[model samples]
Target: MTSKHSLRNPKDMQYAFSYFYYLIHKKVPFDLDKLWAKEIDINRDGYLNENELRTLAINVFSTPLKPTTFKEFKSDLYKTCMELRHPTPAPVIVEESSSSDSSDSSSSSSESSEDSGSTAAVPVIPATQTATATAVATATATVTATTAPKATTPAVDNNTLEVGQKELEACRIDLEVLKASNKTLMEIHKSYAKRTMYRTSIEGTDEVAFLMVDDNDNSTQTKLDGVRQRRHKFICLNDNINHDKPTAHLVIKVIHDFYESLFPFPSSFELPPGQTNHFRYIHEIIDKKQEENNKNNTFIYIFGVVGVMIVMLMWKRSKRSSNGNHHSINGIIGGVGNKSAAKQRSNKRYMIV
Candidate 1:
């Protein structure tokens, strides 16, 4: 782990280790190009750490991985760790991230930049460990774990319980955060799809329609005839999109163009239930993209607030490591799911044991 010269990219080292972690702990993407895009940080002229990385594996992997894959991860785990300077003291979490970014001063626009404002969310350690450690270790670990909460039991160390509650609460909070992020993204997608819908009582003269429409709005029942030489409706999921969901809007736009070319006039294409309506779908995709852009701005703001929690977790984990407090999950937590909150609290009480 000791080397005289710093690796050309410490973050690369971090990324490599994180990549190894995914290779070990999580799934890996299949496409070589997509995998490379996920693996390398083209930002800061080099690499990036875990949070900012979009797991290629997560994107491409659809099902459970074979058990044997873990062996490969385990094999490379030590080398990658040594390269990354394993179990290195976690960083002190920083609450505020000023764009006075010394690191990536020369990157492209927010979209292209690797500074996606995501940092690793330290996973939740069960609360029981906090109880078993000595008061001194408990106090230090609390600082690393961070957050605000009260003691639940009298027999166990009150301070330990207080801190455990905090970290666990923080974990729960972060889960909410990730959930909110995904939810917002999905919402924007939906809204974008909706906005693309173009249902207007036109005198019927927009040339983009795939079918040539001959609708007369003045009539009691206008027959919206499409243009003669329109093309087939664009099939969305059929084609391979290079980028992630960000490109969904573009795909929608392409569909719009196809619809316009195909339907020459005012005729509406029949869409199956729960599928996209040509007009509304197109409108939604456009609005949703703008929303996505706005999210990038908001992400910075939201991340600024959470930065402190992330740093604190690192700091706390480091502090715990220094004192030789060890923790890992076991069956004492009871069956995986369906445990009542009370039971979970009790099981967590024994996590360290």
Candidate 2:
């Protein structure tokens, strides 16, 4: 609201509303000074006033903000203002001393508008003006004094307190809607992560998976973005799994390959110092392969040992038999040398060649 400055920026209203949200969130109450600093919402150095405030509330309170964009916020504002102009009377309960008064109130409301009110089964307000309504909410003493300032606004009819209560209820509804929407968006992100994850057995890129190294010298080995290590999502299609998504699969594969090229795993992987979970997932896959290889090597070693032991046993047995036969033949030659006369008679009869 700085004297307009001859610069017509309609988006100013949008920025003001966002700051209004920021301040209210900090639990810092608003006043004129805050507007000067541009921390508070202003329509030329005054609080957006009750009317404008209500308009803002309606937009903020209605259908959930998807992505919470400025455009969405402005759209909500317009919608709320339109709705405030024509309010539907909710079926409200008011402890009344008499039934006739209630009838008079209902008749007045019907006559005031042509729409016949909505049949949405809303709660009805018992009091028509704010003064009496304040009396019920507070103690018995302050109703008359409080009702004076409210006389200017028509919404502060005989059931001013009731109307205030209704406004409060609307505000509560808006709060609930925002909270629920935030939860929904968070859930959607998680769902997206699970379906497109390259967490297991894919081998390289998603194999060792992707990593990110920021200026802080911190490394993220499992995800492309350091911030979302738990659930990283990319668009990929598996033609083998789904026939219609071949193109989708091709697009994703290209991205995966490109990402892997950027953050290839070195011979040794240590996901910096602090990145435990991502490191752990990669480590698990690596550890499984190592364990399998170790098991195979161990089996080979055991077999080689057994084969060597059997060969050694056979060689020892053959050497022992050869030595025994050689000793027996030598013993026969020594005994025959002493019997020469018998040997000569044997040679004559046999005609030795």
Candidate 3:
């Protein structure tokens, strides 16, 4: 959400949020330190102050930001960048090489002292030769021991260098990924910014007012008056009305009256009274069509009733004709039977004679 007093330009706000979201998710593309130094840390002082960041924002977004907005943005950027950064590992402490060197020297001195004591013993021809040989061997062993390689600071330094090289290689890989991500981000920003222009209005100065009034609110007129007094370049009025309420019509009337008060002049599209109200013309047309449909339905019902009555009359006539035909057929058969019976009676009379 953006405030009118802060970064009100929608394009600028959109980009700001996109950048901030990337930071929050640790996907900020560029190395934060590099970005800060290159873009925000003016004077190359290794620290980003308010002025430097504000200048960067204006240059990048092509719009000035409110102080409060800049401060909030800076704080969020600082926090997110800090969270994304990896802490430097502490150096490993190697025990002193000097300590080991001192121990070796003490041992070598003890061996030399033992060899010197053997040399100090009384001389016998064979004993002297054995003592001299033993002393010479001990002296040679001591000299070789003294000259042997001792643990030095350079060896410790080499181990430290290897660990550092590993860390440096890891950092280089991360930096490469970030650089690629940063390049892609820059391209996107350039294309998007070119396609969509940012608003150039001054911060904290708004030319539009948006007012929303509920049907139950009694101070709607007061709000309207305030908007009128401001004489804004544009004004939008929104109503929150419960259409199911009985007083909805009254609220609608109040809204209509307010519009009339604001725009009393006639437009070319408006029709005079008694002529068709274009605003309600659609409703009129719908009502006329409904009435015509009702008349058509009535005619269809009457025609159906007449057709049913005619069919019933034809059915009754057909049934009567069938009954008359059946009666005639029965009378003819009775007449034939009566004649045959009379003939049989006559034949019987003849036989008796």
**Tens-digit lDDT track of model 3 for 226-281:** 76677777676766778888877776776667667777887987778578644455
By lDDT rank, best first, the candidates go: 3, 2, 1
Q: What is residue 123's positional error in candidate 3, in angstroms?
A: 91
What TM-score do all the candidates reach, one by one?
A: 0.14, 0.21, 0.24
lDDT of 1: 0.39
Least well predicted 10-residue stretch by lDDT in candidate 1 = 214-223
lDDT of 1 by residue, 150-237 (tens): 3332122212122223332333222123223443334323433332223333233343332222122222112112223332232212
lDDT of each: 0.39, 0.46, 0.58
Off by over 4 Å in 3: 1-280
User: Which runs of model 1 end up more than 4 angstroms from their true locations?
Assistant: 1-62, 83-220, 224-353
lDDT of 2: 0.46
Q: Pick the candidate with the highest lDDT.
A: 3
Looking at candidate 2, the ten consecutive residues that score lowest on lDDT are 212-221
lDDT of 3: 0.58
Alpha-carbon error at 261 in model 2, in Å? Answer: 8.5
Query: Which lDDT tens digits does candidate 2 get at residues 1-353?
Result: 32454453664555555665554444333232332335224345332334444444344344453433433443343334324443444333443434445456565664554355664444545445544644454442344344334333233222113223345334322322322345323432343333321232322344233332322211222233432343344323222223255344544454456456645674455456456553446678799889999999999999999999999999999999999999999998877876887888888989965
Query: Candidate 2: which stretches are off by over 4 Å?
Result: 1-244, 249-301, 331-341, 344-353
Model 1 compared with the native: what TM-score?
0.14
